[model samples]
Target: MSIRIWGRPTSARTQKVLLALAELGLPFELTLASGTMGAHGHVAKGNEAFGVVDTPDYRAMNPNGTVPTILDDGFVLWESNAILQYLAMKYDPDRFYGSDIGRFASAARWIMWENNELIPPMHNLVKHTIRLPEDQRDPEIAAASRAALGRAWGIVDTQLSRTRHIASDSWSYGDIPMTIRVHRWALLAGVDALSPTLARYYAEVSARPSFDAIRDPAMHLAG
Candidate 1:
């Protein structure tokens, strides 16, 4: 199979796919598509990567012009969570993607929750704290975002009290997105400690070598 993925390694969404590939032990080509490496020698919107996203070639594949678009053989896929599910199903069906309907749906449910409930506040906190300049950063907004994220994680902590994993007794695709977000939240300054169960889960999941390989600190975007 021929697989080529385009996206900057720094993007958490892009990193999600990379971690899955590593877990699946799949070999694929990677072209920097939305970060410094993907900026086709032009800077736009104060972010060269964003410039790449607006390019005609990139837009042709993903109208959203977002990072983490995958070209698997001749098939094209976008949306990071979708990419993760597809890759898992194709490469490790009985494992990451799940072997039955119940497990598969559970994975999908958490992926959806990550996108809908968790990501917004996480993105806001990152934007106000690290992405924005000091003069532009709003403490109130950051604090509110952080508080919202804390509450979201609190729910996860409660869930962990009942099960060892997010969706099942064992690790599955459902853990990937939330693990990434939890780790991202932990990186922010002044963030509170995770609840014990949640903290233990984060420590275990984030320790996967697949995550360590693609999580480059230098890849962080300042925008």
Candidate 2:
């Protein structure tokens, strides 16, 4: 079966999907869109490489006009985390989703937590720092988000001290979301330091070939 990913590479959510694909060694086509190209009115045509999927057309694939949507063997899916889980289960189930119910459930729990708890604050940090106009940016909100993120990082640091991976002793889907967020954390405002354990872990994960291939330093939310 063929797999296609539609999104810009710099997006953290898109990185989630791409990272899973890289980990699984799945060969898929990437259709680039949004950001500069979208702003310039270049729309994606049918299944072309590096083109933006048209909104009406993309909505047909995914009702939401969001990036990082995936098409697997004609079955369309959205949500970056969900796409990661699907790729893991379909291509690398043994290692990613894990082989047993308990393991899979544990991984799923962390994925859910990352989406609901971790990503919002992380998104806020990135958006307020870079996406918003200077006059429109809210320093108070950014400060609050960074404070919350520090607490979250502390909890993650504690967990990493005890476990090599987030969900279990082995790497699983749990690493994807947290790793992506940690990359953002390294760039976020007021982040002068990270826990030693978390910093080491981030170094290890970010150094992966997959990360090196897709992560663009230029896309980092500019200070």
> How do all models score by TM-score?
0.88, 0.85
Worst 10 residues of 2 by lDDT: 39-48
Candidate lDDT (C-alpha), each: 0.76, 0.74
Q: After superposition, how far is residue 34 of candidate 2 from its true place, in Å?
A: 3.3
Which pairs clash inside model 2?
A: 44-52
For candidate 2, write residues 1-223 as lDDT tens digits. 6588888766778888888888877788988765333322222211223444556788788776678898888898998877877887777788785676777887888888888878888877766766655676789888888888878778788888988778877778888888877777776642457777888788878887777644665455533
Candidate 2: residue 161 lDDT (0-100): 92
Error of 1 at 21 (Å): 0.5
Cα deviation at 165, candidate 1, in Å, is 1.3
Question: What lDDT would candidate 2 get against the real structure?
Answer: 0.74
- The prediction achieving the highest TM-score against the true structure is 1
lDDT at position 153, candidate 2: 77
Q: In each prediction, how many residue pairs overlap at the backbone (N, C-alpha, C within less than 3 A)?
A: 0, 1
